[model samples]
Target: MNAVGVDVGGTKIAAGVVTPEGKILDEVRYPTPHSPGTLVETIARAITEVGDAPEVGGVCLAVPGLVLAQENKVVYSPNLRAVEGIPLKDELEPKIGMPLTVENDGNAAAWGEFRFGVGSEADHLVFVTLGTGIGGGVITHGILMRGAQGSGGELGHVTIQATGPRCACGNHGCLEALASGTAIGRRARELAVEHPDSALGRLAARRQILGEDVTELAREGDEVALSVLDEAGRWLGVGLAGFINIFNPEVVAVGGGVMEAEELVLEAARKEVILRARPPSRDLADVKVATLGPKSGVLGAAALARDASSREYLLGG
Candidate 1:
């Protein structure tokens, strides 16, 4: 069977046809629109394009923020201002003419990794995407954990410092405030300004220095970039340590653009987790990088639809 997976992100909308084996067949992409209506229309177009294929069974949408399952409404999305309370499934299902499922993008990505990627070997899994901010998902006993209000597993918002920098969420000292890709980029830019002679500064002079550039600089042994990544990784570890105590997942899969820094980031994060997390929990969890890359969200969304269809068929019989 096959499903169409839509990854509705802040900057882009990626849709793909995914088989039961978790392979993405054909894909389409478009820049995310400004308004809710346009966004939905864009998604509908992508689904139509992908579902034109013969084997497509359903559509799965991976959305950022809290989605109310009962109403299929996106309760709040920090990145997309126009999407709040929108009946996403109701709007898209008819347009696409297929059974549809909506999931938190992080949850979908985590499930994808669990079923097809790095976390497949572990029953308890946590996936943290270190993008502009951190997005997390947890799966225990092979089921997604959405919490009571469908707002659970928000690891990025977990407070690491009581009196730290202000977050976009209006909170102080949230993990996102300290360890997000945006935070990393912002800090790198600041350091570049301070140390105008730094190699990173030279790169920033030509164009806006991105988080990836910082990672590259660190890889090339630039001290400023290395220090920035270490600080960010330390904070990441601090947040994961708390999660380790609470969830005790068997595996923690880290992905996102920041993971490009590889050892530079992971080493510091590991150090912090070892120092802060409960010894048993820390020892139990194996931290690894996700292998699916940018396709994780779409692949996971498709998996959600495929799993839901199988379960429905089983129960119906």
Candidate 2:
């Protein structure tokens, strides 16, 4: 069966019709509006634009927020506050002419990887995206492990250092505060000030140091930039090691913009995983890059939509 998935972000909205095999049939994109009404209208329009599949069973919205999946609502979204507290299913179903569901963008993306990307062969998988903030999901025994309120698998918020940097979520020492793109930038700026003679320091003196800039400087053989990435990666691995012990996933797939640094960061993370993660689990878990990249949200949400439809039909039958 075909389904439609909408990946709604702070900047843009991407909607696509997808088949069971994970091919996108039709797709549309729109700049996301900040107001509640316009956000709803934009999402509805995007869905309608791409939902022409003759047998689209359902639609799922991949939203960046604390989603109440049972209610098909987003309770809170830090980056895209426009989506919060909205009756998404009630509003979207009427406009798009189909049943709709909602999910955390991270969870939806993890499902996409499990279904079609790196975790295709694994029954247990852990997927994390390192962007402005860290977000992640877990699939264990072929099941997406949403907690009691459908807010589980929040890997980014896990605390690594008790007295470390503050997170946007108001926590101290969260993995997001140490290993995300935002964290990388913040750390790079600090390092640039400390080492004002290096290439990173030279650039930071001229303009604000962004995460991509750190990666570029590292590629050009700047020791200071390389150190910043290594620090973040080690922090990430510290968090991942705990997850490895708890979930024992066969694969740990990392994605998002920060991954552009690739091995520059992952190499350090792998070393920490080896040092901290217990034997057998550490040896068994394969830390690698996610293949779906940015499209994971749309594809995963579509797959979840199909899964939801199948369940409903079976129940009705």
Candidate 3:
């Protein structure tokens, strides 16, 4: 069986036709639209472009922000303003002529990784995507834990500092406020202005200093850039340490574009987790980079769709 998975991001929408075994048969990407209405149209167009495969049993979307899965509504998305409060599944299911499932992008990525990537063999794990923001999902006893409100694993919003920078969630010192791609970029830009002779400053002068730019500069042995990532990683570790103490999962997978920095981020996070997390919990869980890379979200969404389709087919038979 096959299904369509759409990963909706702030700047791009990636869709893929995937098989039951987690193979992506085909894929396409398009720039995200600014209009809410057009955004829906763009998603439909993405599905169409990917091919209307007869084997496709359903369609699934991995959307950012607080997703009310049962209602098929995106309660809020900081990056994509237009999707907030929209009944995305209701809007797209009919147009695409398929049953649909909606999930939080973070949860979808975690699910993808758990079923097909690094945590495939683990019965308990946590998945964190350190991208534009820190999105996370938790799984325990072979079940995805969505709290009473269906927003249980929002690890990014967990407060790491009582008086740090502001977060998109309107809170201060959340993990995302300190460790996300946006936070790294913001800090790098500030350091650039402060230390005009630094490599980060030089790159800022040439153009905008995005989080990836900082990581690239750090790779070249730039002091300011290196420090920026180090700080971000330390904060990431601090946040994970808390999670370790709380959930004590067997494994934790960290993925997203920013993780390309590898050692610079993981090393610091590991060091901090060791320093902060309680003994056995810290020792029990291993924090590793996600193997699925950037495709986790779409792949996870596809997995969900395929599973649901399989259940329906079995019931009908």
Which digits, one per residue and each the tens of the lDDT, describe model 1 over residues 5-75?
Answer: 88999999999999988888899999999798898899999999988987889888889888776576778
What is candidate 2's lDDT per residue for 215-306, written digit by digit as tens? 99999999999999999999999999999999999999999999999999999999999999998899999999999999999999999999
TM-score of each: 0.94, 0.97, 0.92
Model 3 pairs in collision:
none
Q: Which ten residues in a row have the lowest lDDT in candidate 3?
A: 308-317
Better of 2 and 3 by lDDT: 2
User: Would you give me the overall lDDT of model 2?
Assistant: 0.93
Q: Please tell me which model should have the higher TM-score, number 1 or number 3.
A: 1
Runs in model 2 deviating more than 4 A are: 311-317
Error of 1 at 51 (Å): 1.1
User: Candidate 3 on 210-312: residue-level lDDT in tens?
Assistant: 9999989999999999999999999999999988898888898999888999889999999999999998989998999999998999898898787655654
What TM-score does candidate 1 get on C-alpha atoms?
0.94
Could you list the CA RMSD of all candidates, in the order they appear? Answer: 2.4, 2.1, 2.8
Best by TM-score: 2
